[model samples]
Target: MTAVGVQPSAVGRGDVVLRADGLSKRFGGLLAVQNVSFSQYDGEILAVIGPNGAGKTTLLNLLSGVYRPSSGRLHLLGRDVTQEPMEARCHAGLGRAFQIVRPFPEMTVHENVTVGALFGTRGTTLGQARERAYDLLERTGLAAHADKEAHELTLLQDKRLEVARALATQPRVLLLDEVMAGLRPGEAQEAVGLVRSVRDSGVSVLFIEHIMPVVRDLADRVVVMDQGQVLAEGTYHEVTANPQVVAAYLGTEEGLHA
Candidate 1:
């Protein structure tokens, strides 16, 4: 299927890189997530879209090991990691970039990324991590800003730094929580290219996005969520055309073109 903004590469989906089966989370009286299930295949770019309080962040937290599901299971690269800690999950090939860009303010951009490369997957030497971090900085177009302190970069540069740091982990699946939330139109377009390049490099991507154009352009498949449950899932065109999805999320069939 053709994506709206950037055409997806001819990468065939292989084995499941990540799987969530019947996952749910409860917060006191609130059931934030309800039995969410989905699989991310190797080399795929998946988008999860929903309105406010739709449990998108909660599901992301579950996937990234920020919160263990109260029920169900999570598998990464064929191994059950439902009970794994955040660091354990990172070492097991899951990486996440949060909605906010929070870098070590005093550290150089390069040093910030180096931390991820060093501890991300384990066994990486300091020298090796530094080299890798430099490479990632180059890839993310932040090499020019490498020596600058994290607090010195602009919002877009900070966002790039966030992605670069996450990529430093060498994860099989990257979970991005609204990486484009604060970007200008041009910046968002640039960020989209970065994501495509990341997928081209063979890491599967799962993102939660509010921007319809971004999702339409980037997602190979869309999983629509509402009221803490999956409302529908399909190609951007297919799901946007779904009446249920239209009613719950898109508002109208014309919303698809929006």
Candidate 2:
């Protein structure tokens, strides 16, 4: 697919899909995210990266309504949704996958995905939802394990299940938090391809990842955060080559910038 053009004003407009401004969150004395601002255009993969405590996950939490920002403005599809609850955010077309897999251990893969279908972007009848869930499983290469208990799947399969479940919600923009964390090299590549396919299907993606290669391969733009604020924002090459990013986060490790 061709790269989309950048429109600064359109980014925060109602049609922009998702926008964050001066977003911050605090827990007691620790400031998780501080005055961070950015926007995700429709049908684009925007990757968020930083060092271990740079607040990447905290930013995702605030955007998805998992944790309300201490002070900030959040807009989804042009509506002021900063104070919306998690469920309301989900209904507003926000889907998320946790860094730690959270599928129901006792439920079948299909069943778990069905919960998303029932409560996701496009609500469907049971039959339609089942068909959609199966299609999503097939797309993610998990069709054979549809009937398997969630706990019985391998780590890679478990991660794919999380993606499928999020897809089942029919979100307009999906927030993936380290879905590629534990995968081997080959597996990570395959997962990256799957994410590209997701974006091609017209859903936007905002991903937080530590694997630099995956970020380079999947993101149309990269946003770097450090010390609770945006440290840099640009294409993969620009962000990686930024001196501040290298010294503070990328370091001299080749793998960190892969």
Candidate 3:
């Protein structure tokens, strides 16, 4: 995997890990995402951002196989996966963490993560899965709370558990949807570090985020969407500076600071 610090083009055209080609999703008459396309390179953190209902989550759903595209194609590590189901996509190295953290309330944190490890890619023995789950708990800072019930955690801890569960799947490209939504600034900063660590481990991350500062800090590239269409794509500074992107977010790029 290439380092995140390098320009994406520097990785060469062949390094594309996840590719979306004219992807769209529709519910009756509503076209949630329309002809959206982008590429996430090896070891890059790419952010998708827009106002509420801009179809960021819908696009993520399309990527993760939560919804098959109404039209167009999706490629994971160069394999066509447009028609695959969620489990198949997971097997193809796609992982997702939803904005709403939904741990099994009755399960211990360790058990919650254990389920992921055991079921993710298939093939691990029970013992190996248990061991991997424990390691992920430690890596995600949930080791101390491993024995605690999932419902006993703070919001931030729950968020970490969400991420840890996803990481247990060992995805090559992890899709995170608003993972930092309800976090305090300090907690968000910590989450930023965690995301960086994930990228450092060679996972290409494509995330949907509403928080601008978090996007600026974590994303090697930004994809801006508005009213179900991609408005712009570039580095944080470049996209935020785009007139169309600024207007879509609300008048000026400074609006992101709000």
Clashes of 1: 1
The digit string of per-residue lDDT tens for model 3 on 135-251 reads 999999999999999999999999899999999999988999889989999999999999999888888899988778899899989888998988888898888778787777857
Candidate 1: segments with Cα more than 4 A from true spot? 1-13
Q: Model 2, 1-56: lDDT tens per residue?
A: 12233234353323478888889999999999998888788888999999989999
lDDT of 3 at 126: 84
Residue 59 local lDDT, model 2: 93
lDDT of each: 0.89, 0.87, 0.87
Residue range with the least summed lDDT across 10 consecutive positions in model 3? 1-10
- Candidate achieving the largest lDDT: 1
lDDT of 1: 0.89
Q: Write the per-residue lDDT of candidate 1 for residues 3-111, one digit (tens) a residue.
A: 2221222224666778788899999989999988887778899999988899999999999999999998888888789999999999988999988999999999999
- Provide TM-scores for the models: 0.93, 0.92, 0.93
Query: Which ranges in model 3 have alpha carbons more than 4 Å from their true place?
Result: 1-14
Task: Return the clash pairs for model 1, or none.
Answer: 5-217
Q: Please tell me which model should have the higher TM-score, number 2 or number 3.
A: 3
Query: Ten-residue segment with the worst summed lDDT in candidate 1?
Result: 1-10
